[model samples]
Target: MTSNGSIATTLAPTRETLSSSQLLSSSISSLNSSSTRQASSQISKIYRQASTLFLTRRLPESLSTILPVITSPAADDTNPDASPEPAPISRASRTTRIKVWSLYLTILNAIVELDPDEGKQAFGSKEWKGLVNKVRDGDVWEEVVKNGYGGVEGDVDSDVVINLATLLLAHARTQKVNQTRLESYLAASTNPSLDVSSRLSTPTATRPHSRSLSPVKGSGTDTPRDLNARVKILELYTLHVLLRNNEWDYAREFISISSVLDEERREAFLQALQSLQEEQMESERREKEERRYQEEQLKRDVEEARRRRIESEEREKREEEARNRRSEKGSEIDYGVEDSPPRPGSSKSRSSVKGGSVKGGRSLPSSSPTARSSVPAKNVKVPPSLLTRAGNVVMNVRKLVESMAGSFKTRPMLLMQMLGFIVGILVLLSRRDVKERVKSILGKGWGKVRQTAGMGVKVSYI
Candidate 1:
């Protein structure tokens, strides 16, 4: 009975498995018919909404809105904890996928182009810097490959590749990495590896629903639109990016050997490259000339300034020397005036005069040697000449008389009294007895003065 139960249990599970497989197959068949139309419609709706947000300058919202449609459940989601991963671009219809990716790239480019403050305000500093760095460092290309192309370089759509190259060109500082990435993609697209063994072993029945839904396009250069896009990519790589990197010869070789470019297009590209090279050379020459002119002008300005400064200093020095010379000359004139001998009739000479009598008086000379020798030689100043001394005295007397006369003009009564006294004196002198008495009195006073002087002289001699 136990063996019978085991067999029944195993048999039941097998039937259930068969039934589940049949249901899965039927569901897949149904999905294949309708999934393409449904996915295209859904992608169109999502793309329109995201494009509207982007046009309205709502970048973060656009990024958020578009993310879900392009991502799928993670491969490890069986654990119920793994996060969703980005969906491969091949999962969407070709046109929708290109539109979605172009919008996404444009949004990223816009975000990178935002003013730092505005970017930081919309997305915090860390997030904004991360986005900008992703674009600038050419990491966005790798991201598109890994997330959108299932890590298949050759599988990247031409339009999407063009967009990626454009984005990197606009923001990236270096083009070497971009150049290498483009070269790899071009090589891979041109020479795709065919894994015959993998294809033979993997039966068409067990293939993923997504693969059946979106078949891979045969070649990039098949359609006219595809050819044009491929040519554009080449133009960007050769004309824009390679020129920036100065890979002139390599660009020429690439254009020459490119399978997509016709002979006419090839000639046009070469002529353009030649023109660009000439323009670059001309621009460089102009820049060098301008730089040299600026340097020379700067040097001339410095020299001019230095010369002016020196001239100013020299002028000041000359002025100072002239001022010093004038001061010295003035000082010498003052000293000369101070040290010069006094003039003949000056007040200093007048004070030096001695032993000069009044105008009508005669003074006796000193006979005693002791009197002559009494004064020290250094203390004795030479008297002015007799005539000059007399002239000065006469002038002084004349001035005094003039001053008296001027005073009399203001007081007539005082002048009259003085005249009357002089008349009285003259009338008294006219009397003989009066004249005799005046003469005797004058003689007596004169004799007494002579006697006193004689006594003094005798005493000194003794």
Candidate 2:
């Protein structure tokens, strides 16, 4: 009743492809076919001699052999005789399935060696790092395999084992191979059913031979237990495949099954594969998108930080310039008395006022007209020598600044201001009284020195 669905039949090789012939025939065919007549005969003789080494005689009466028998169906169609007994059987004489046993032993070792927390250990190494890597990359496996333990490199032996095991498991999974029910299949076939009681059973034809309705055997066809076995075998053999394969072409080899199945089963297996493929694609896409998003966000953050940093630097520069501008304006009215000389006859002693009253830390002269002769001092006035000297200094500074401007073309605004200052200095230099005041200041610089308000900053000619 159980039939293996598409998953089982889709990839498993058939009997003809896997080669159901005897070992002798298979061996001969596999050998080099370019031999001369004499060598070919010699090879044939050797094969014939070797094949006879195994003991195989006719099976006895009372026990039927599993293989097909070549006997004719009936001695006569008119009358029936008691059916001849099948081959005899010896209770103690049972043939062991040697391949299955060996397979089981291998499976046992693989399972026992497998670690949940770690992978399988390579041939000699304690660490399963080789197992973590691919099969061909395992050094221990290579050395041991070269020493003659593992199968030949580039062979499909591992793939065959796993595929076969998986097929067996698929059979156990009770997957159906066909869509039609047993009765419907029977009806469709050429075999005509007769009443059991009226007609005697024929020994040769116990079972009907109908290709259309052949019963699907779960043993080698469809069973979940078979699938479990196959999965284990696949996992185990993957190690071998990794170790031996130079190319993975063989791993991809699978059957294109022509066997028809029920619509429900076909739809189900296709759906499962579809879902698995979809999930894998989705995961990869998500990872790619996440990486791209992170990169873009990082770029945006960096750009924003740079923009902020530039703005802050500009603000700081502007503030520094403003403070410098205020300081420059303050320089117009000298804070340090020594930095700018006083007008003639206006002040003398800078500290204690020698023989004159101290006013605002300056000493006045005893001969000053403003202090004594106030009866008719209309013509009395201050000298302009000091003022003249200060005006000359300003003129010299303007020349020096214009000469400095020759070395730079930037800061045009600052250049214009310098030009304006030059004009102001020129006007001051044109006044006749200012010139006299400057001359007097140069002759009698104050009677005595006054207190120093601040350190003097000289604008030297150099």
Give the number of the best model, judged by TM-score.
Answer: 1
Q: Per-residue CA lDDT of candidate 1, range 1-462, in tens?
A: 899999999899999999999999788767753675676788899899999999999998998898776655456745766434546344567677879889989999999999999999998999999999999999889878776666678877888999999998999979987898998988887777567576446443333234322234454788798788888989999999999899999999999988889999999999999999999999999999999999999999999999999999999999999999999999999897555555666544444344433356753334433323332234567889999999999999999999999989998898999999999999999999999999999999999999999999999999
Give candidate 1's TM-score. 0.64
Clash count of each predicted structure: 0, 48
Per the 3 Å backbone cut-off, how many clashing residue pairs does candidate 2 have? 48
- What are the runs in model 2 whose C-alpha is more than 4 Å off? 1-219, 222-262, 335-462
Question: For candidate 2, lDDT tens digit of each residue in 1-462?
Answer: 135666567546664555655665556433422222333344344333322321232111101221111122334545567443321110001111122222322332332344534333223244343432322122222321121111222111222334333333222222121111111222322133334543234332222111111222222223564444433443332222211332122222211121222355445434544554567579879999999999999999999999999999999999999999989877865565434433444433222224445458664665453433222223558777988989999999999887777644666677688789999988997899988888788656543232221223232322
TM-score for every candidate vs. truth? 0.64, 0.28
lDDT of each: 0.81, 0.37
Candidate 1: give the clashing pairs.
Answer: none
- C-alpha displacement of 291 in model 2, angstroms? 3.2
